[model samples]
Target: MAFSGITTKFTRSLVIKMAAILKDRCLRRIFKKIDFVRKPLRLNFVTDNGQHSIDKLLVANRGEIACRVMETAKKLGIRTVAVFSDVDEQSKHVKMADEAYHIGPALARESYLKMDKIIDVAKRSQAQAIHPGYGFLSEKPEFAELCFKENVIFVGPPSSAIRDMGIKSTSKKIMSDAGVPIIKGYHGNDQSNERLKAEAEKIGYPIMLKAVRGGGGKGMRIVWKAEDFDDALESARRESLKSFNDDIMLVEKFVESPRHVEVQVFGDTFGNTVYLFERDCSVQRRHQKIIEEAPAPGISSEVRRKLGEAAVKAAKAVGYTGAGTVEFIMDKTHDFYFMEMNTRLQVEHPVTEMITGVDLVEWQLRIAAGERLPLLQSEIILNGYSFEARIYAEDPDNDFLPGAGPLVSLTTPLPSRLVRIETGVVQGDDVSVHYDPMIAKLVVWSKDRSSALRLLTHSLRQYNIVGLSTNLDFLINLSNHQEFRNGNVNTDFIQDYYNDLFPEKKSLSPDLLARASVYLILLEKRKQRKSFDDIISPWNLSSCFRVNSDLSRKISLNDGYSDVEILLSFENDDSFKIQIGDNVMKGFGNLEINGSQKLLKVTIDGVVSKLNVVEHNNTIYCFSMEGNYKVHRLIPSFIKSKCEAMNLGDAIAPMTGTIVKVNINNGQTVKEGDIVMIMEAMKMEHVICAPKDGLVENVYYAVGDTVERNSVLISYLKEDEKN
Candidate 1:
């Protein structure tokens, strides 16, 4: 019986087999016309081959990865050419490169992914090699083919290898033929909806609809039941067409809580290959890896050997050369299956490098220069554990929505023996909505997985980034998770336990509060000194009230969700020591006494911190490393009684976005759940809906206008009045 008006899996499989027969025949014919003869080459870096020296290299991508490639090329005495879209002329990558060329408009399709323009720029610039970083045209076989035709070395795997692995259906067939275990699925070309439905039915409920030609989880859907097949199929097709220009999809059985593992492989022209072991990329959101690590924890040595062997077989099947990754889906049973092969360098290649002391990019360049594999498989060693956390310009609390704007403040702690940060952005750089939201990558290395995790967590907490929202807190929590620390992770681990990962806590402890107060005071003192101002007027002196000629005030703090409250007293302008409930915290520091200027140097548990106090109206604003806190000087009891409520009807735009679709009209009656407007920011659409049934009192702006954070969209009348 047919499901969702789609054909049966058996029929779809036959159609796929038939399509493969035809496609293979066509590919064989095409391959016959292409010459695979090795060219006579002279020694380059090893010997003085001046005529064959590569004068310039063109980077055929954008963003952090492009900048990274340019840095390596520049250090190697090569002139670097950066190709950019109209919107990226002033980008960091463009500024860092030796020369810049405008390819087209901002959209990737019109620029970075446009092979012809990229090739044209290379030819014009007289570049001897083209490096397709990680994304964009990195995996496209045609770009590599063009580079080969023009005699420009493609700093990646051979074009033939890319072609063989580019198509999912064909790649699966090749891997399966090569004896690699593949996940049960139908990798066929029966685009008929009916046929797809049948394949899904065979795969059983909870199947995945995956695009045959794309990564980054684009054009992918997980249908839990047969009834949801048609809608999912359409959605997957639409996304696939938009992302990869290919609507052909395959159905595979969904493995619940499967860990994502991949083995890094490198091959040389001398027919030698070595596996760099495995990296666990299971911590993901929306199928994009957020954290990755090498030498997957909790995995057995026997399993590692099996995975490595499988990856090598998959690579050898396509005659793979240069840097490539063989990804796999491992279930709880420890049974692994081939996912796909990435025929280019991975973004997380640094973690592998940290552990193995191997520079994969340098090896890529050397291999491209006709060098033999420096290390054999037996020589490859799995070293200590390493972890990488991808720092992105996105809001974790807001469903991890992408954030865009000028980076007002960006600072990372210096790299040490255990911590490393690879970033391409600088202060004042604008994070545009047109590209990926990643800002940098923070990597840490240690002798063991537990130690590596601990080091990474500490580094994240020490990192300070202002302006745009980030996943720093979430990452820290994830690193400390028991499951993650124990290395018992899978692709679904985050989704299944996200709520527990980010817990809602209220109010700081008395010691922490004391520390925060001191830190704020110090910060204010520094600012005042910088401004060379004394006795700053309008500073809230009432917040620090005097009792019996002593400049000290009693303050009450409460846990918002509970009735628990704690009282503590602080001196406004005196060095004081206090013992509260077995905790001895002291406020002692050099004080520049001035009217209305209250500063304190406090030591909590032997660690000194500062605090600054400023008064506005009757409220005191305290700024510290903990966060901003406001307290009333007149009514100290009110501090623990009620916290200020976040105002509603104050529709704040999620990010620095443009109003793309304005659906509400002024004075129009709308019910709750109605979408009033939609904003486009960071390449994603955000829908603003009415919070309750009410009449729209006003429309704030029109379409095509840019909006900042906290910008009001529309106001709604009271729910009772609307009814």
Candidate 2:
């Protein structure tokens, strides 16, 4: 009895010492609160067969999804391993993992998609399970089967379930047999051209032709007339073959102005399944979702029940045993039809988690370890509303084409209880051309839809990113759209409200220009301060203070709308008197930068703003709530002539992509609307057409050649010189 007492006292002292090791006070408190639920997995995970241990997990993916998965795994005290390609060696996900391994080259086909390499890494790392976060190998049945064979738990549904839901045609048939409403489509085995054409004729014009194995808006086309059917079919087939290596397709009647909604479902090995309400993902550009929200608005409770029940029924039919998303298209009469099943965690899962107060990844791990769901249908609570807006490195004015470059400056709102940020890149990280160019996701929540939307709008305006083009301004405009605020969501929302969303361009105001000029001078002062030799130089001071006289200077500012000339008279070190055209203003502005210079806190004319600044290629890019502006300190006397001479009447590449086809050749004469070439990027095709009637001098690139943005692909002889 004395020996037992001595041993117990030693164990208690060790526990106390371990608790004191957590240096962060807040983290220590959080750990204490979670200690109750962090009991040994072996206790509750044991079954009649044996004990399944998942102390370590390997994430067979990269980017934001991989980071998101690791967060929950770490919270549960599970070790994480990360694999990265050559380009992703310095990625955020790689840095977050407890251990990292080099996979392969920069291309995904050689790295993330290599099943053998990933399995080899998992074995070497001694991982007990593998988490295929979202994209790459998440939905591949073969990957899951291999993991099962290797005795490593796959933190997802069964392989058979993945196969059943992967193919659009097969999933549609399964849903129909399960008594779920399906859109009228031709999901038959007939692949011959004649049969597809006949099906289209039966369905009538305005048909939707989609590849049986496609996602992310690829391998899909909409036909409005009979004459356009053949071309659309060939284009869709070509893209399908490139994306999935399968050209099979299905035709359906195009449902106009329908809302895109999906239900989140989870199932366990115990055969219990539950649905977590619905998400409206109707705001899109080029058939890709840009904004999503939970607890779909303007829908009756009866309709909500139907959606949730249908989703659960679909999951049970496949014996799904993890998190999955079931998508549906709702028509004007509130009738919803099964579209397809994602068969994995979705990119917009955070919005659902915020409303339901559930951690989906945690549930995924528990279910994979053969544990019953922690909550039942009756226990799941839905409170408040949430919104998630996807931020991408793309130019909205250029048909929303994707962009690739370095993120020289990135400053986002601080994450808190009501706000969350999921990102994959940091300052100075490159947005590679080999993968999707999504920068991050901004999420917000509130007590109601209006309040949540208002918070989202405010957060977006405060998100400052520079050194590459982004769709930040466009997303802000979309959230503030009147129709969107009223919850009038539909597939055609963007097209129907195009005018209001993208109004006519407006020139920068005098006050805005003056503020930019003040910012430029402050940036120069900062540079001088950093140089030891110029710290006390008189030339570094403001123009007025240096000479004690009326100082005149002219600067130029461009915000992608119009260029303006600002006449500045420096009043003092912290203020300026400026004029743009006929308007004049006097304002005080001061810039306080953090250690890294990525975040610039400023106040101009009593309005405080936080801007992200990047000085590259002799130009200063200032990103703020007003908008993004590029300022040039010195102006050339022949600036107008220089700008006009730069326009060479050439068909330039809109973005970095691979050339797939060239329709014109040297010495070929083309009309104004003639197709010149085709380029593919981000899994979509873009057509380049002739700008005017002229003779093609030469084509710079051939098929399968990579090209950069704004590079001249086809130069044309001037119209006057053509004769």
Candidate 3:
């Protein structure tokens, strides 16, 4: 069957059942060969050889992953060396490392991808080992080989293992030869476009043009029909060249709605291998995993066994040592096929750790030091459910475009059953364009998948990040999705439900806005008290600061929102409730007053929310959620008049960026929806269009010119004028 057809039939729920059947068959065979001396196998890789420890290690990567590796190393009393580019001088990884080295320029090719410079820094810092941290040199066989030749331990799989699995085409062949089920595709090396097209025809439509050396969905395209093949192929080839510097492309059957499941396997020098169970990474966007979970939901015991055995076979085929992941595509009919093997630690390793209670990094360090696997496959158990949501600095509403700017405010809820934020970047740290936009990994664990999903959704709602766009809303919606809750997932889940998941614009309710305004006013009042000692008066009993303002105000609220305005009458200093229309909202807060200023500290829905109010010109401007809004303030008459008088042809540039393309010319007649210009900002192209049918009066900027925010790019005359 075609890959897409096979994948479309596969769903996460059905794959779980298939996994159980496979597991049973494999285990039964193992029991047949079991003897007193060969009853399965228990491998111990850690030795009591006086506890060998490396003094310091260099993290050859940057960003969150580097910080994550350093955290574990630090816990084990190991120092860390951080390598940075000119742009990363103030990066979180650089700040976290005990020692740092400047590599080269901001571009990755000149720094992070430069293995020689990284090694030189390690040597200069006297580091004993180097941890690649899952990008750049993580899966590069040459890097491990160089580290081995230099006598520095590579804190991952051996060079031989990387060589076998790092190359996708070879990895697929190796897995297939070892009797592992693999996706039927043209793995041949014929890079000619004509040959690829012929191969795609053989494979059937809905084919995927993928780069031989691609990750993160950069050099991949899905062609649904023959007519789209040529365009997709060209695009895939161009992206592959830009991303991997390899124009070599391959034609594969595109899997439709197939679940992405991978088994975590560990091996040691003693030829012992064990599988640490599996993780479901089916929830994705643009071929990048957004949410990951371990002990995959809906998979029966039978299918789990099959996946584990196949994963083990795939690992053995490559002589894999240390930590690695064997990925597979499973359909709803329980059919499974190997995708590829990742010869390094995965970014979602934290999910596995949460479920298994094992530190994969520490084990990787031990294995690289010539140790053997410590636990047998039978000893490993799948425990509770865990979910990991990657918090990225991107605008989910804007096609998930990467967001870059300083993190002005970051607040995470307390770690509990509902929330746990594992982040490296702190407030004030700049999210640069030099690296991936991911800022943190938020993980939630529970006794079951449903509970875990609920906990994740609640936690995400409480997370507050300002100054940069994030995918928080998208994650929240995904967690609460009907398909997700039922374990119905696949790679195309995002695209399938993009419209329902995100709306063009979201507005706050008027009552919620009013409440937010009140909170902001109170918060500002508190701030004024702190800065000035004479803002509050102490002896006025009626106006004296009280702890329970909601009770005193007698405010009634209906369904958390109110339409009727009710007079707030304070009954006491600490307690008050406001009755808005027929609903009342009762709340209390700790009152602190300094001179004329007042402070109210309140807790709402088990989370602390503070409100500060300052009165100026009998109006309030509330500052909360990192955005400021004026409350009860009259609009400026002059500004309102000017807005009312402005014409429809007015144009303004959205942001500071380069004018990449000027599509319009002076005196050119354009329709209402005609594209006038295009600008490139923050690596995304934004098009400026005509507001109405009119003649182009002027073209303010030419291609290759830098423009500031709100700068006029083009202007149009009246619609009646035909050029």
Which candidate leads the pack in lDDT?
Answer: 2
Off by over 4 Å in 1: 1-52, 86-91, 510-516, 519-586, 589-601, 604-607, 610-653, 656-690, 693-723
How many clashing pairs per prediction, in order? 15, 0, 69
Each candidate structure's TM-score, on Cα atoms with residue i matched to residue i, is 0.77, 0.89, 0.76
The candidate with the higher TM-score, 1 or 3, is: 1
Worst 10 residues of 3 by lDDT: 35-44
> What does candidate 2's lDDT look like per residue over 119-200, in tens digits?
9999999988899998788988999999888777888999999999988999999999999899998989989988998999
lDDT of 3 by residue, 294-361 (tens): 88878898899999999989888777788899989988876789987888889898888777667788
Alpha-carbon shift of residue 374 in model 3 (angstroms):
1.8
lDDT of each: 0.75, 0.85, 0.72
Question: Number of the top candidate by TM-score?
Answer: 2
Cα RMSD for predicted model 2: 7.5
Which of the two candidates, 1 or 3, achieves a greater lDDT against the reference? 1
Model 2 segments more than 4 A misplaced: 1-51, 525-550, 558-563, 570-576, 596-614, 623-646, 717-723
